[model samples]
Target: MRKFYSTALVGAMASAVLLTAGCGQGLLAGDTGSDEKKNEPIMLGMLIPQSGSEAAIGPYMSNAAQLAVDEINAKGGVLGRTLELKTADDACDPQSAAAGANKLVTAGIHLSIGGYCSGATLPTLPIFAKADIPMIIPAANSQDLVDQKLKNVFLINGTGAQQAGAAAAWMAKDGATKVALMHDNTSYSKDIALRTQALVDEPGGPETAILEAVTPKESDYSANITKVLAKKPDYVYWTGYFQEGGLIARQLRQAGYTGKIMVGDGSVSPKLIEIAGPEAAAGLYATMTQTPDTLKGAENWIADYKKKFGTDPGPYSNQAYDAVRLAAEAVTKAGGTDGEKLISALEAIDGFPMFSGPLKFTPEHTLSTGGFQILVVKDGAFALQDALQ
Candidate 1:
């Protein structure tokens, strides 16, 4: 990550000012006395899986966000107002996410910094747009999100196209002549699967032997395995969440297919190893941006997280933290919670420090470089393997 100086530091300080300032009068609120309104907290909203197959990840994201909130509040709060976090469960479902989005909007949140699943996040775009709430999405990087072109929406996670290219390139680098791509057919998974297929089909890349979709939440996937094994692929890539991905990994190994196995960012969790069994997951690889364990120069940050939550931070935790800081920065720059002003403030950001690197959104409001790395399941934990420079 790049550190800022001079004017950049001044901009950062301004954002810190916004985070610490007492909440000012909101557009919807009554024009109460300035003194009373100034002491109110600025509400930040989040939506994540709380009671679904992806429930294990909710705390990781939410807690990190709260941690950021706590840090900012400790420093005396934004615009002189303290920051408060309000959360609703999306359960990684589209309908659930839409309802949750509406709940957050009704609650008068100034900004949004949550979205773990792309399919779940997609439907909420219009919901937030209608309410004019700016979203600094920490995860859920489906290319479809960018396609929506919602001015109020921005992503801090790497997009599917970037992950696809990283996956295909890694497979080819491993000398695989035939690669099998699989997904659960969700919008996010399918996008990565299809894009990877296209990349591998390029002139000098590996051949796409099979592109298969399996229904999620099934106990048995022998039929799908049968199809994949028939192609004799030297490499297999699974683009789905941890629940299904873990099962597929174990099943593929149990079926006696010994090819290299890799998973997408959605599947890069410690729970994947648990579900797949340590032995089955030992050689697994993942295409992902840096996670807490895999990130360099994050010891103090991780230590602080463990101290506050009494548990180790995981995937998306850093992103969630960065998202909150980014939101505060924009708020301070914009001088208030006005949607259009916040959008312009975020767009104008340059050289902001993030776990990924210097912050600058492309025209589509995505990172110019996905900053993906190759990770392997070493000793039952995902560890960095290559930077893919």
Candidate 2:
């Protein structure tokens, strides 16, 4: 169900310039000489999962990026040039992501945002690197992404290490003496799970008894549930998307294992309750990247997003918004859009207010000190359990 606004509506809402090489020669025939130069548009590509299992989160991120561009253009765009976002659907698949990356490069896009899935983003990294196009990943948090050290890639979301550290600290504070770690075997899932295990297993930290890996597409997890139950862990932390996390939570409860269950940001979606049923999802805890609705300084952004999209914003919407805004700010600071210049600008960002917090990049181009908020399922909805500062 793709919803497209009227051409007039799109133009009014966003000063979009749908310019291709030879799409409208008649419209530009009369506007010769100097006027043509003034109307030229700067293109920023967006590679998102518009069709796939992860598609639910993609459109929100893309919309957030568009919102930032619209706001930027409304108040005198970069170098007096209007910024236009050209979107390509990667479907959260590696092959598709590579194709999308190539398409954007061919379309002459210098900067881009998106790729929510790490598996998809990883394959496309070389494509962006070869083209010298800078990509600001809004939601991919796999540690391997940074470990690869691609010169043109930047991550707006905190890494798996950050999430795992916050989660381990919270669990330890909650008196979880023995914890079980479960992952879906994907790069993002396994990385966070392993990190959390290491944190909990450290000397003087809480003891971790079990580390289990499960296929994400498996429907039945009774065997795994039985194994986890046998361990008698005080808590179970699952690192995976909503699909598997919901199923594991459901089966774990069904198998009479009632430990304190927690999940990473992937399981924070409302759909988890629907998949696992409200009773099964009850008391489940999750750590998520800050959201517009949860953060104090996001009221204006939430209002504007609702006004523009006619819906509530998703969990990562603010992160995507910040990603685009930070990219634009970086481009401005660099006085140009070259890859090296933009990378330096991104690293040099300091004390900028974002939906997350006062933004400052570490030497590695990661968030300096912000942490994830812990949420628990209460009355069939995710409620804030503890605010992380």
Candidate 3:
């Protein structure tokens, strides 16, 4: 068990913003606890981007986490205590993430979950290391975070290599001869692309004609399109977010280039179609991160989510929800809020039922059984083409 001390922990816990949207006062219903346990709510900290470019995902992560907390509490609570969620906005920046993590530590939370962006999540690892709080990561699957081998940390989502390996499987199945792998300069994008490039570079794989980098948020990509089109690769992979992926897809299609544009899982959201328009979005393929509807036994969960939030679960919602649910379960299994015990419990988890899939953490603290799937854009929507091994 870890004890909180007064260090330069961010401006007290009160200074941070709460992610619980409405009716936060009654987050858990019908949980009547003993007088001693009533005053103590299990605080679980969530550090994610609530502002900045990746803010669009904040609601999905927080809402899903809150739902898990509510569900756990509704079932008589954990360890005879009600779970309370505390959130801090990392803003997808390293410095801000460290500050936000500090707020969580100062709040004396037992454990923490919710990390959307890799860059933001990387810096906060050391903070949690020092605080000795078990950190359960929902997304932010960069290799760098896992390479550190932090005992206090665990990632529920598939790592970049695992995801890229799946892409390689789909590429081989599709019989792509020549390939062009592209990425925006972000750490997350580069890491996934680099991993995929490694797989494609291996023997029995397609020839990578052009490995290129594109400026994110640029309205025009004619230069890139022209340069890459010269190689006439059979497939082009864009390992970036939805905006740039859609833009480049639109540009390439408009330029009369007939090739499969495979956007990475990070960029395969519905927003991609909105940005690329109907014509360009059609006939495109994208790798997918976990989605609620795609996961097994998640139909009821998705319906409940839609009923509660008025929208379907987004990219990493299942990951976020599972992270919270598993973390809470670990706490219960450990029989207390002990960081080392929680880590042990997490490592020992075997075929745990989650919305996304049955999960068991590998030696690297990542999911042991999972891979990405290729989704083709039909009628301007992501549709399953093939499952990657």
Candidate 4:
């Protein structure tokens, strides 16, 4: 699924660097002291769920990565060497993620451009940190990822904290006096749930009716819905993935407990509509980054993706694509794939073009603007409801 190559340009550049820098201190020749073989392709690694309940998203992210790689290679490659993408299956499980991270490190990837489930992504952080590989995370936005304070980690997606704020704000604007928060207990889900609870408990915010947790992958959630309906909340928010979220949505609607139903980004998949049934899923709301269908002026890109993959681009595809381009840019700006240099180059990025907006990271290494918008499930698809301006 990957290709590598060395060109005369790369060999010449390496010879030039070695001649001028002199092999003294930590400064080396064209190899950039990164110890990579001269003229070898710059290796990029990705860890996505090739097999798991979330496997539906694997193609969206991986195919986008390949698209970026092909585009970059066609344009003279990165740093005179073509980029090669190697992937490992994280399976959206912590143990699997850890093993996959190690596999990527051992394979000698210069950078990582993947992370979908925060629960799975969390365990891989220390693994990558220990190996000194900089990560340009595409999806997984758990604040816990930032709390670790690992310099090698950089999140391109909005953080969980930002999503929580957006969710709570939307609830207020909808005139909800009481809200129920539900989570699947995954790291990503729980982070948003806890943060939203805190924000809604603040002065002038709505009353939090209940903070509920549900076991994921369960077939039934009627008991949980019963507990929630007992609270008589005017609004309900589910901060979890689509599988459980869809069932919960359908159950809530069946139980006649719907004031309004909204979900976090993880629940923005079309499968949500299928699982909940179109009627039940109708009018469903989500706090999400712009998807291919909702992004303006992206018709051509989306068409190309469809032509390539034989289907429409899904959620997180643009983010994954951006991650690849950002990785290539960092490598170019750094002059090599040295992890430390790449980190510095990424920190220095300012106003780079991205589908969400101009790209810039805060001091905390999160997007300056979360780029979350309100999306509603209408006629079995997600469309922009509010840009939150």
Candidate 5:
């Protein structure tokens, strides 16, 4: 759900070239481009999962986008014109996300924000790039997206590569000499699992005892369980979502294998506790981007957000908020809604303060490597872990 106003749209947007038209006596008044640019609204799109397996995340994403919109509007709107948003559900699936991206291009957005699941977000990149729309990815962080090298795409989240490195480092710190790397064969999960496997493996790589893949969304993982238990590895790193991850944790405990368990970024949902039960979920490590609650100087904002939204902002909500604010600020700084100008503005950002952290984008348009945080399920919630220990 989004709101738009034609009358207030882009009224204040004026290019430096256009503003000086009247100052030059030789220039014709008709050549001033303000008339052409001011009539269009500063339209932005949200390409997030409103419906799908990840539908649970829609509200949090929407709330963050709306919060940014509200704050920008209160500050006299971006570029002195009202900012508007149009949302299209990406559904966290490739085909669906592509359709949503097309819908946004058809609506003629000035820019776009939001991309959650990497599987869904990947296929939509071409659509945004082809339309010349700058995309600000608040959450999706697949290495594939980075490899694509599209100029219009920017990601505030750490890449899968960074996440994998974090996991491998934690394993080393934990003294997990014989670790088992497992994945559920999903794009997001498998990518991290494979990369982590490579990092932890010897140059020649490890045997089957250290690597495995499982079918996703299955209620029973006993078949895989039997195979894993046979190895007796000291730690199991599951690069997958919480639904299956929780079950694996429970089964590991049931099978009486007591080493340690850690999950990938996608498995950070609180529902993991429900899936595995509180007891089994306890002590399970999760490699994830820091959420608002865990970030320094976010306590009051988190409290205010909970009061306003009726729930703690979900995974990536803080980043989503920062993405929106960044887009708005960049558009204002450029003094117009031009996509190219916005791209330049985004790249110029250096440690811009956000609730999540002081955000800065690299040359590749992704966040820095140290964005990840190690979390453990302590007393049914994800709390920061002292990884050194």
Candidate 6:
């Protein structure tokens, strides 16, 4: 009987060793710790336009991302390990963006949130795609971006086609005929303006009077403004960033073109009002992915953001905030930090509540549905005009 008991004890000990081996393999495979104390912090990367022409809106994005990380850490973080942010500036240029992407790739960061300019984001696409790193773009909205079929890139903000459709509908409703199209010739600006113009020229659509393209860095648009005014358009649509848009607005108003004006998401900056002057910028309409002063269900976020950054959130702040939150959520749901595991978690997300709208990615990693809001400049601030479906 004693011999039989010893054999049974040996069998039990062997089973325990097998179980331990299985658990260790699982932990190693998923980069998870068997105990809370052994868990390592997860690193998240940021690649925003911290300098160059797009710098005015960069800090708000960075601050919003920081706020998301801080809030998640305060709430015990993802899987009990802190989320670490490693930021690299893209400078809103393609070459610089590529360099920043390579730096992040070398540092072993597979998840990142940023890239404000499509021009800058375009060159980095290959870098991230080859490395299989998942990048969540918060604000780059050019239509051609997702056409590359990169498996790992995702966009929280809707595409240029979405915004262009909204803008076309609003202009048609407002009785805009003989519309003039102005763009800065950048991939993003020109794509938005051209797509919007195409929508306007569809069957039963408004007539396009003028289509003008300008250099982004040109200081004086008097020549282009004069050409647009010669068309006598009832509405002038400018698709470009804030600096160029403000310059064009001032030049157009000065050139005595007295029709309604509209700008795209690129011009939705507070500094636009200051640069164009309140009177010149007043009554201008814009379509944006988010508005700082008018986001619904974001009062708490806004207050917290202000408290932390000592400034109000900007246009893409909510989207950037949502990107970080969604990343954390994926990490927690996956129960670990493995890139493939996180990708699966992200794919499984549906109706994840966020400051923007329900968070869900299409098969191609685009937002399931385009989400944006119409905003109008009033009294030196942005007011929500309506929600676009």
Task: Locate the minimum summed-lDDT window of 10 residues in model 5.
Answer: 1-10
lDDT-based ranking: 1, 4, 3, 6, 2, 5
Candidate 5 vs 6: which has more TM-score:
5
Pairs that collide in candidate 3 are none
Give a tens-digit lDDT track for model 5, residues 43-121. 8899989997999887888887887687567656654567787888988999889999998899988788989988899
For model 4, residues 281-365, the per-residue Cα lDDT tens digits are 9999999887787876677678778888898898789899889888987876677778898899899888666776767888888
CA lDDT, every model vs. true structure: 0.86, 0.78, 0.79, 0.85, 0.77, 0.79
Q: Candidate 4: global Cα-lDDT?
A: 0.85
lDDT of 6 by residue, 169-263 (tens): 88888889889999988888888888988999997858789899988888899988888888899899898999988888888888887889999
**Count of backbone clashes for each model?**
17, 0, 0, 1, 0, 0
Model 1 poorest ten-residue lDDT run: 24-33
* Tens digit per residue, CA lDDT, model 3, 25-127: 2442223223224448888999989999999999999998988788777765666678899999999999999999999999988898978898999999999
Q: What TM-score goes with each of the models?
A: 0.77, 0.79, 0.79, 0.77, 0.77, 0.75
Which residue pairs does candidate 5 place in steric collision?
none
Off by over 4 Å in 6: 1-38, 49-58, 92-99, 175-178, 184-186, 205-210, 213-233, 241-259, 269-280
Off by over 4 Å in 3: 1-41, 214-227, 254-256, 269-271, 274-277, 293-297, 309-311, 387-389
- What's the true lDDT of residue 108 in model 4? 93
TM-score of 5: 0.77
TM-score result, candidate 1: 0.77
Better of 2 and 6 by TM-score: 2
Which 10 residues in a row give candidate 2 its minimum summed lDDT? 1-10
